[model samples]
Target: MVLSLMNKDKFLHVVKVSMESSPYFQLVSSSDAYRAVPPGASAPVRIRFTPSKNRDYCHELVCLTARERIVVPIRAIGARAVLNFPAQLDFSKCPVKVSTQQTLLVRNVGARAARYQLRTQSPFSVVPATGALGAGDTVQVTVAFHPLASGAHCGSLAVCCSSGEERIHTKLQGEAVDVIVGLSTNSMEFDRTFTTMSSHRTLFIENKSNITAHFQWKAFAAEKEENEEKRRQCLLRPPKEVPQENFPEEKETEKVKGFCGDHSALLSSMDQEKMAKVKLMNQGAIDAPFTCLPSATNLGLLFKFAPEEGIIAAGGSQAVQISFRATVLGSFEEELQFSVAGSPRPAILTIKGSVTAPSLHFDLAELDFGDISFGFPYTQRCRLTSSSAVPLTFQLRMSDDGTQPAVDSVDQIRRDSDPAWSKGIHLHVEPREFTINPSGGTILPQGHQDIEVTLCSNTVMEFYRRLLVDLEGIGKGVAALIITARYQPLPGLPQALPCPGCAGCSCQGEVLLNALMLCQLDTRTAVLGQQPVVKSTFAPSPARSWALF
Candidate 1:
């Protein structure tokens, strides 16, 4: 038997010995595998003879061969590839490639390793890197591409594997970032020295950019100056064919001075939120919204003054005086945004100040009144009187000391009404004593004693006899006893003796010596030179005996 194998096909040989037939060996050749048929049709050899040589001997030999037809279904072995970036990458400068040696990570996700190569399309190239990756193994690779000049870039990395070719395509898109630079107009005058001034501005690269932007700050004395003819009109205005040219001789108005003029580095790394902190400072004396290197570009957003940014205490108000240098002279506008970071509302602050008003109010403070006393009534009067000014009517209310009463009375002491000359008058007096003695005495303008009240009483008596004198409105007053009290005792006994037995009498046991006598003093007396004398008389008590009486 002979057997051979082909590139993609298999061959087999078979030998069989049949026990029920004449013993014989047969051979078969495999050919035209696509067009072959079954082997069950060949008949077995049969031999018949007389039973003379031996007692009916029978034998069958069978040869068997089998070969499987090779029919394999090839399958690819990879998953979707991914790329991660820390920040937004500039597609114009990034590396990309297609299937040919694309130096990037490749991994096989199926049960086997993938033998593959890399290639690239336009604007991309693959480095000298190749890899055969297993199910989970990743390969590092390098790709180089002349990034897109502007706008979005797209391409694909084709992976040619042993099974077949699979495409892993990638697209990169980006936007152009303008390079920003800082500028300053150190000092500009509103008065015209030149008919027009032009600022030559330059730019610095930022955010990995190659873009350059040009700006011109043209100071026009008047609107008509923009069209005025000049000997250097060709330089001032670009040639029709060369509109991109820049003229530096147009006298750049110094530079727009910053808050801290020399330290422009403070503005270099500013973000959109931080650049907002820079503004048209000291605007009242200048044409502000100060022109920067990128003139029309809104690089300087309004400063956001948050309620929390300035020291707005729970009880105290906050005043933000964003100071700046006097960089130029003209009417201008300064704007700031007052906002809360996480809040949706925004406030605009447009303040006006001037260099002519440049006096530093270095300190601003407050007067705090904490925990004041309410027990005692107090009046603090500040009097600023202009002599020529008319006298204003003041209504006065009375207050209390710890021991006094609170009274509200209108005291209209005018310049013409009896008493006039005085200042803010606060009076504290004892409580009212109208029943015992009249209170609240007033003296005229000329220091003179006018009215005096006398109160007299015996040591044993609780009540006092009062005498009152009124000299309140008396001018050039003469001191006098305008009122007096005279004692005129009625006709009565001069004295009384103890009567111990009497229910309401004194403790002494002596009986009443004499009944109370009434003494009479007559005003119509006869004697010319004698003072009036009392005439004594006795009155008898009805309730007592003669001895006791």
Candidate 2:
């Protein structure tokens, strides 16, 4: 606050101003103080008051001059500004997917200016929600209601002050009513799809009215009436063509009055006896005249729509994707409802498709390498064919046994190698017991893949491995090959099976067995921990001939 001081006398004079020192009162124009107050000219002193609390303040202002000392009193008033906001607001019965707004009057009742902010949740919003109002000033706030569904929505509006840490909440209530919407297509027809595969179609939802439209695809309830009027609710219409009204007033059949001219007492007696007989017939068990045919099952599991619930803006369109997937093989025909909030009834969508098994197979079920020589490598080839309409990705792995799932045991002794000397190799001795070239690959429709499988053994063991064929994308796994191979120690490497890097032995033509790695019967046999010796000049005694006699 600035106060003007004047030197009323017509003489050159100096004036100094000071105020009582306190936390709430401070001098703003210190340079102007203790200055020469020219004759007939005025001087101003500025003072600032910062209120620490809501209370009144008083201070003394002192002025010094050459003639006399003048004293003045100052007071700081703390009048808090108040904004009045309503306790509750209601946007009654608004159209669904449409926005309805109302204006509100907010007044500042105090002698000071106030700034406030307003906030709320979805379906309920405030426009120009934040503002500053002068003392006794009133501002208009528009509260809009945009609901997505047909129901009552409740929320709270908060008004917070910029100066003080105080907030006021106003309870908000709104209701949404229904409206008519249009669609590009009402029924969907999916093509024939493979089992465990999907076929997709798209339909457009048109919100042609002024309001936005929210929709959901709700499945029909079980045990519904089979009336023709009810069935007509779910239908397809051309663009801008409105659907038939669902609740049409049925024509009531007028009752016919029975006033026959010829009436006999004896005939009336016979009719009463017939009525008694009909009551006796109802007392006994009655069989149904017709058979209960099987109704179509709910297709929600196999038929689906992407973005099952969403909102379309006013005068806008949304493309909804429809997908059909089945796990079993059969033809399917089912119907469900496409319900828009505030719509009289849901639009019926018919989905029809068939699912069959995709044909994929191997030429040979089992790959058997019989009597494989030890310390040697053997290789074989097989073919995989695909007659499916769509391409398939496949991966090969050795099963734990002949049962379903298994682990890959390579770089040890079992299963096929992760690909011979394939990836991330370390210091390894043997090149696995089994290995397959191009272990994993893709096959196009009506295509075939030729696989090369190699077996290189360094130990004496029999393998009864089960090769598992895993189909990617569509996971229909089948235990493929029953791989049977054996490797055992021999007296010498056969001429047919040649070993190139041997120190003492050479298969130039054939190698003769001069020594045998044999054990004495009395000492030890082919036990786990026993070792045999090479008896080069061995001649057995004839004790076995007497035992045979």
Candidate 3:
């Protein structure tokens, strides 16, 4: 009976449907396109039970109903690809050779009832002598190929699965690369031997490539003439264009130059090999100076050059624009150089401009320390101006906060000069002095306690002082601590706090008191005392009885 059931088509339907939809079923028959299902397929599938051995009638019936299974023979095929190189293939060379390794995946691609083998055609080899594919199963094979020549290469990949194998040809592709060379030249000439505050100049970029081309700007460099020692430091020049503003017939300037050069170092330290070079392509061209000295006297263009955007292509050339406003009046020239592609050699350009003080304004017009804590650090700032035609210096002083005196210790105060804009003016601040603590706390036996607060300023100077007090341990029976400050003058001023009067002024007042501020010593006692007492007056009553006796 089981043998008869094994021959039926019930198992075939089960295998077909299960293999088609089950994620568990990857390997499939060649008729089953893994990419898509055939036009006439059922939504849900049925399973079949096939028993090869013989069984009793009742047993056979039970097996058919209870032991039935939907077998979807999963057969799937996949390939692995990799690139390998031969000993002779060098990336630096004109042509490159590469090898590819391929691995094939073969799985059971058939109905539960069917089983088969995988085979391939020409130019390919399968690993095992004879491969057996099981229902709902998979296997892999390896293959290798080499491309001998240059240029783009193309080919096909093929595979076979159960239920009649089919070929899946994926186009194989690769390429060999090469390099092309080109040339360019940059020469500098001065229109006037003497450079002034206002100087007009044009920077030229020429294409020396054999073919017409579009090129990306790489970078530019400039050098000062050997004799002009004072003029070596130059400013970075703005580009060729500027936005227009209100006011008719305004002579608009296209660029603004920035100062450039190691003004801090001596001339003997600067040699050709160690000279500064601007890289335009990889090395950034000077867009603007990050920092400058306040006393810079000469001005000039400080910038790098680069091939214009797009490709440097074969031949065409592009020029970068350079212009400037003379900030300092003087005679100066600086040598500049920029590099193109891979060549170590650089293009040389020169910038000439003058430097004078621009209209000066204070960056830190004024400063408000806001409010500060006692014993904590605080700072205020104010910018000074040198536009008065002469370098000036001003002193900084801390004003009184009100009730409290400003800390006097000015001996530790320090001043700093801006390397670029301080212009002989120094910024200084005195060390912070003064602190606040709980003055006193008191509690009465019957009601709430009241506290009085006092503050001490480290200095006798008449300045504002700010302080913070934290209180604790004050119970509901105690009122908050109240604070008020008063000023008192000193007989004499100390040498360190020489800036002011010997008197200190009042500042912020009124703050609450707390229980933590109260120091408690508990007074507890258990008393034991001796005393004499008479429970009954037996002596007088007994006296009468004794008299009778």
Candidate 4:
């Protein structure tokens, strides 16, 4: 019971409160609970009554102020049934059209018997919808979930009593899922690729269900399985045809199992030519600079798929690329598996390719800068291509003498000025001169790198040198670019004007054009006044010094 205490006096006053109580009654607030009240102001106080048995209970609340005293009565007639129930219910992740159930513990925790009526909407139902319980009685109420559609859904379950006069509500929600997914194809084949080169192919994922699905790419097959397959193939092939070192056997008899007496004689005459070119390179040899650098790599790490994990929407598709790259020389094959939610089994994909040494070459084997003009730069555009499927890591070096490795002798060469744009070798002699832009770098598989080769000379002399591309991981072969040019002073113009008519007059572009033509083409003029060459004459070009740009 609660009542307000008002200060009837025209001034401020303090109100004091006291409760005459029983075991079933309580003072909701401490005595002196409502102390200060301004003139014409009021404050509230409360008294509580609780019954331990089905019997009547009463309590008195006394309020005292500076002006008056009052008494407030608090009462509890009887105890009715109070319930104990779960705060909320959840039916986590159930398949559509399927039923999932959870129990709701309903108990009568008060003094009297009670009957509960369960009510909720479709896709959710409660068992023993109406049940009576004695005082302190407990029942296990079954709540079933029937998902009508995919995705998250919500509803409410009502526990009603006394014609809904007293009721309790619990939340209802669940995740409805229907997953169906697959791949466009079950197998893949890669192109023949060179070692250290990357070759890739694309496959698609198809989601056929109404709900979104998650997918993952994995390599499920073990190396032991691959060895078993190799071993089986070894037994089927004849000893002479099989690569003996590639597949080892547990028993020695397996190596010569099917080899008859005459077949053993065939093995004795081993092919000496097969191992003929296994000699180490000699640095002193003239062609030593053309040799490629060697490389090593792990085989297990050779194959990989891009965009490792992702989601696929309902009735949607995604494309994924699988790539292969190797550091060793031989044939290689690897297996990959694709697994997704709702699929009974993972999809198997095979990746197989051959890895050979890198084969890199320029479009042209040589660059000829015919006639060089002093103080002017002659430039040539060159394209370096990787024919094999592997990358080409290289070093571009300029050679004074075409027979030696120039990259290692960089410290021995001296230069007063270095071209800041030149990446590798920068030093050049008075006339054996050439510089490369982006002197050293890498090239992608089946890709090309564009570079500019600039040749310049200050002295009048002939120049002969080579530009070497030392490719990494190449067992043997040459990537050499030969350069040849001769520096010549511009030919002097005739002292007398070729056109006699312009001798005493101001010189025009025609006179200069004719003089240039006479000096370059060695043409003798025969009174061709103000007439240009029948065929167009070009200026000195970077490609050919005699032909102009």
Candidate 5:
């Protein structure tokens, strides 16, 4: 509240300004006695009120002057429902994938009940969506923060009362770090001849701190379930004739299974030619039986590491060997997780590369249509080139598979079969509407072909679709084209006008059009000139003003 004082005389001297007698009100600004106020000038006093009960509060601002004494009254009513929360919840430096929780309290200080709903953004969630509190009742609400990626994440948690009378918000902040074990490289690549020869790469694991760190490492192949299913289906199909050059010699067939003498011997061998032959023989044997080896369990067969597990001294580093051999010709991606002994979070390193064969090649991994307006159609094109020496036949089909994993709700995520509520967004794809030109055809060696895909959406939402391309005959390779799109509503729709006979309403349509045009012109001018444009006003008719009853 502001208390204003006006001096009508030539000059007024303020002796003191005090609120010492009032317990509920206090002056927020420092007051100076003997301050001179010039004639015809005003002075303001700022005061704050702190109410302890839900009742009328009154206080007096007393001013003692050389000429006279002034007393000003101030009054306010305390609210019934008060939401008490901290200004911010700081979960100082947390490890990645770890969750931390904080509690907020809401109290009802009056004679009535209060109902409130809690809302927060991604990476932050409340336990209960809504709750009710009786008179003099208090409830606790839990706010959780779970970091999905390594970085600084922040958002807000808001509590809104049902009466729309009060809204309280608090900032949520957390930093995710994975600094215990530092890796030399997060990614590794293999040459095109991965199937015939084994490639070796070394990664240095260094302890970032001065403390002795005990670390454990493991390699996991991504999309194991999907890869298993694809492998099973491929094995069930008819076997194609193996090329003579690609086939293993009959003499060295028995040694394929145990070609790598022992883990230690294999790690010590420096003969690149012998190891290449061993890898080629093992891959040919696995392919001959129409069986694919799962990379997850076959890591031991493909790779040999010296000192697989150990402890690193303070600020020490160790070099670990990572060997790669591809049993099947395609793209392979794996994740290496390094975890400290006592830490709940692990640092992830990704390893990915393609083992190219004599087959078709696509330049892009996925297609993004960006944002499109509802009822509008969009078309995108991609090229497929034949990298083999022979002609390749391919078939194209659209898949109505499940939606991709959503990272938006990383904090409130639950299992699909969990009893908790689940929200899913699905995209409908019509085989007839999503057309591909020259759906199935053959391309000559070293030749290229263009494929066009047209998409349209009738709803304003995000969507995801997959286009599966299958190569015919010998290779029987499969490629997936992930398509994503977001549709939005058109802009610049007319707003609702006031009732014709209501107050501030004008019956003349020209007046309304002129007002809108003026507003648009002012906005455009302001944007172009980087300055405020003066606005013109239209006086309302006297009849319209009198229509308010």
Candidate 6:
């Protein structure tokens, strides 16, 4: 008997079926338990009935859900013969041009013997066309599957009883797979200088099969003993998780209950279920359905895919851009593995490259003082190295002119110089403000020099200056080392005071002079009064005094 179950709720509903206190009726085959049934959709539940005695049978089929439980009634006569067979046949995965076989057991569980005939469609044939089975007897029917193409193939098998009973039908399914993929190139090589800029290469991937194909590309260094040990150590470490403090207070309270409190325990269990479901959904979103390999991380190479990941239609192509930047100066080799869906082995693409050090190079492109206070001094240092085999002399000067020349221009100047700029050498920078010590220097092959630049400001404004360095023998227009600095205002300064002098003044005249004489009664008094003493002191000095008023 077939039971059609329909969902009426808006949200997803999970259904399960069971037989309640009915020994004669049993669940044979049905939709999976805990299966999600969408709203307004139906799922089939198949049940079988068998009787031990000759009489009418009655039973109840129980359907359980999260919202409610449904009871379905079962009624069948005990005296009838029933043919039992599997609901479907699955050949699973079969390689192209390969034949696979499966068996189905047919049984007669009834009061009398029965005659049955088996019929199947193309791509599938049964071993026995007709068979007879006594009561409580069984027969095995073998089905052969031979696929010619790559894809899912489907057919059906039907069984008929001579007693004019319901015809039993079972679905047949099998999948044939032969994946083919092509790449435009098998290897790539790059010669890059050690710089912040990255070198890029494009790989063309084409799908050759009729079915859509999925591909994943990864870059990894060649396997080494030390690298393997590091990988092992990385895997040994436990995964990091959100701290307990990040959890909600309610969740913490629930955790504290320890599943002892009835309400809190129920809620905690429900929350755990929801969290598990959410985690599963998130994982499904991140990982492709067919991918079985663990995701790789920290392979050292960076890559950008036009379409990070998606289905490539048959005869379609995709572009994958892989970029590499070497942090150190040396020759390095790496591998890029392309994993195609259903393929056991990955396609390995070789990548080999070398990074050469510049002949004359600076440790950094620019030095930044960030922010400096007024009247305060700030100093920074840069290392310049001559990596060539010959002695090189470099001259440093300020780009006093407002116009700053390009580094390429400095390089051109060096190239156009009398000695061809000493081979693989260039000048850079134009300084407008600030002071650089040891403006010029000479260094032996593979020698290093440190240049110190200091900046001091007295005004309350942004200060910018560039220091240019050039080769000693090269012309002035050649490259110059460019150093930059900026100054900020400092705090605390005396305010301006108002002037006491008149704004306009023109006074240049002297007043008439008057002389005064004083007569002293005593010599000590005369001395104390700051008067010039004369010998043989006389007391009549009143007539000798003259006054001008």
Assess candidate 6 and give its lDDT.
0.51
Ranking by lDDT: 4, 2, 5, 6, 1, 3
Residues 1-549, candidate 3, lDDT per residue (tens digit)? 011123232222222222233322222223232122223442322233333333211111111222234332322333221112111212222223333445656544443322323233333233552455545566565544444445654444443334333434444444543223234435556565565555565664554434343445533322233323323322233223333343133222111122222222111110101122222211122222121112223332333223223222222223343333332344556554333433333333444433432222333322333322222233333232324222222222223323333321121112112121112111133323432222323222222222221232332223433222222211121111122222332223121221122334321111101211131211111121332111100112210100000
- C-alpha root-mean-square deviation, each candidate: 47.1, 34.9, 34.3, 37.1, 27.4, 41.0
Clashing pairs in 4: 197-390, 293-473, 539-548, 540-548, 541-547, 541-548
**Which candidate do you rate higher for lDDT, 1 or 5?**
5
> Who is ahead in lDDT, 3 or 6?
6
In order, candidate lDDTs are 0.29, 0.56, 0.29, 0.56, 0.54, 0.51
lDDT by residue for model 6 (232-254), tens = 44334332333556766544332
Cα lDDT tens digits for candidate 1, 1-549: 222222222222232322222223222322122222233323223233323332223333233323223322222233432322112223443321212122444445555556667666756565543556665676676665554343345565555666344445444333322243444445445544455775544444333333343444666634346423221241233212212124243321111111110111111111111222322122111111221221231322322232224312111223343333333333344433443222232233433432221111101121111221111112211111111111111111112112343221111211212121112122243332112121333222222222222222111112222222222222112111122223333234334332335563333311111222222222211121343211111224221111111
- Please give, for residues 1-549, the per-residue lDDT of candidate 5 as tens digits: 777777775544454787665678878776443455678888777888888876667777778875347787777855556666678899888766567788767677756667888899988888888988887888888888878678999998888877446788888999987658688988988666656687777889888754455566544334565544433443343423344456456633332221111111221111111121111111222222111123355433554434445443322234445555445555555554444333233323344545545556677888888875433357899988876655667888767632332221111122223222112232232213356777889888799889998764433346687887777644333677788886543234232334356654334444444444543221211211343321111113211000000
The runs of at least 3 residues in candidate 5 whose Cα sits more than 4 Å from the true structure, single-residue gaps closed, are 1-80, 179-549
Candidate 5 yields a Cα-based lDDT of 0.54
Candidate that would win on TM-score: 2
What TM-score do all the candidates reach, one by one? 0.18, 0.32, 0.15, 0.26, 0.25, 0.20
lDDT of 4 by residue, 1-549 (tens): 667777765568777888754677677787556578888998877666666667656677887864457887775666567778676788888877778899867789877777778898888898988888888889998999988678998888887765225687888988987656778999999999999999999989998876555667744345567645543443354424434356544432343222111000000011101111111111110111111111133543544444454544322234454444445566655544444433333333344545555577888877888886644567887888877544567778777533322221122122213332122232242234466898878887688888888775533457777778776545323587777887764477432223344434433445565546655432322222454422112212222222121
* TM-score, cand. 5 vs. native: 0.25
Question: Cα lDDT for residue 316, model 2?
Answer: 28
Q: What is the lDDT of residue 86 in candidate 1?
A: 18
Clashing pairs in 5: none
Report the Cα lDDT for candidate 1. Answer: 0.29
Winner on TM-score between 2 and 6 is 2
Candidate 4 achieves a global lDDT of: 0.56
Stretches of model 1 off by over 4 angstroms after superposition: 1-105, 125-129, 142-148, 170-549
Better by lDDT, candidate 6 or 1:
6
